[model samples]
Target: MNKIHIIGLGLLGGSFGLAARRKFPELTITGFDISEKNLKDAEVLGIITEAKENPDSDTDIILLATPADSLGDILEKTLNEIGENTLVIDLGSTKSNLCARAGNHSKRKQYLAGHPIAGTEYSGPKAAFAELLDGKVMILCEMDKTDLHLKEKAYQLFEALNMKLRFMDPEEHDRHLAFVSHLSHVSSFMLGKTVLQKMEDDRNIFDMAGSGFASTVRLAKSSPSMWAPILTENKENILQALDGYISNLSSIRDLIAKSDGEKIHQELADINKIRDILDLGRG
Candidate 1:
């Protein structure tokens, strides 16, 4: 890509700029964010070559890393502004709504619905790092709708970043992420809330906390502005996931209350088997 435009200069967008610049030093990277400081910081950090108020049509790639709720309108408007060959990719957490908005657009083929399953529970340009995307998975939805050449361009860029690629239907993508991704954030946030509520009564509570507690609640530190829209956009799927999670929690709660050691042991043992499926270090 000769010219790349990033709409959001936060963590993911800034990281993409850093990584893209690392791989293609000659390319011009321009960024735009609602927060002017983010654009300024991104430029200062050399994450992008410059900052812009609007995307230029001559750009080869436009990465939409905006909040989930704002993606649909931004994407539609971007498609309207870009050249016929410009490729647009969104890194929103939820996909179904934005994919639906692009479904019948004349320039739909130029846009790709994507989610990079990577990030720390941090926000802003300062939190971005080039290696954040290395070895991470980039999930692309509605790939069949993207133009062949644009898809190849996206694939080349992702491969250059050492990312693994996965494709899924937009509906299926939202459903699966609701369970594996979104639900975890909800759980973490609530867990942190519970602990903070207790800490209000006994400020020393954290004195007894350990690394395990810190790790478990780390996602609670994530930006509410970014997550609120994600949760709302995938409301139906997230609600179903919450139901399943609540049922599981209730079962464990009942087991503990009844002093059913055997059942509790069995439940934990069954859950531990998940380690065989996932390697925490890799993720």
Candidate 2:
């Protein structure tokens, strides 16, 4: 009953295996990855006990950690391979599309859609750590559609990682994440591009950069392969988020051009209220 098979041995998959292993040592874990090197690396690193060719017939749970775009195909393939008793969960960032696919599966009650609201700007199995999920929030979408027993097992698995659980609708999850997570990544990538282009003409630009610059541009280091699909999958809500962000930037630029010092002060003061709610620590 403790056998678990994980597909896509990347950062999230590897992290889950490591976390689960440390917390539940008796469980047997196996994994599969499109990159065979990653599958082998995960096994060699003790993240998983072995490499899985397909979803294990006797596995109690299967975790899919592939990119958002490939989630539906992977989910479908795994559903065809696994038995009805096996529980499957996806850790993709986008939820609505994946949840929709799960809802139509013949073994739909055995599937669960989850997004762990935690990760660093890193990818691949080497980026995994046993404490990556500790105390992070795990959002389980469309819980009402999942079977009660599989839901209970998922809750236990997350509990073993010391994660907090939140239940939400899939579309609601996508809309909220587009503004908070997706928009932040898009902003970081753009900021990095702008600074890097400026640095080409001024070598001293980065010499003047501080921790603030590093922190703000950190997400720019994230895997393009991972983010490209996430942005594409959440396009609509992310487009709306971009519109709001761009409007704010245009407003600020206009104020600066007009030398509206008093207006700028008021605008900045209004934005500072966000700090009161967020523990960004001196941002």
> Which numbered prediction scores highest in TM-score against the true structure?
1
Worst 10 residues of 1 by lDDT: 202-211
- Model 1, residue 124: distance off in Å is 0.4
What lDDT score goes with residue 110 in model 2? 87
Candidate 1 regions off by >4 Å? 206-211, 280-283
73 Cα displacement, candidate 2 (Å): 0.4
lDDT per residue (tens digit) for residues 6-107 in model 2: 998888999999999998889999889999889889989999998877766888889999888899998888887778778999999999888877787788
Off by over 4 Å in 2: 206-211, 280-283
Clashing pairs in 2: none
Task: Give lDDT tens digits, candidate 1, residues 156-269.
Answer: 899999999999999999999999999999999999999889878887643436758888899999999899999999999999999999998998999999999998888899
Candidate 2 global lDDT: 0.90
**Residue 199 deviation, candidate 2, in Å?**
1.8
Q: Which candidate is the best by lDDT?
A: 1
Superposed on all Cα atoms, the candidates' RMSDs to the truth, in angstroms, are 1.6, 2.1
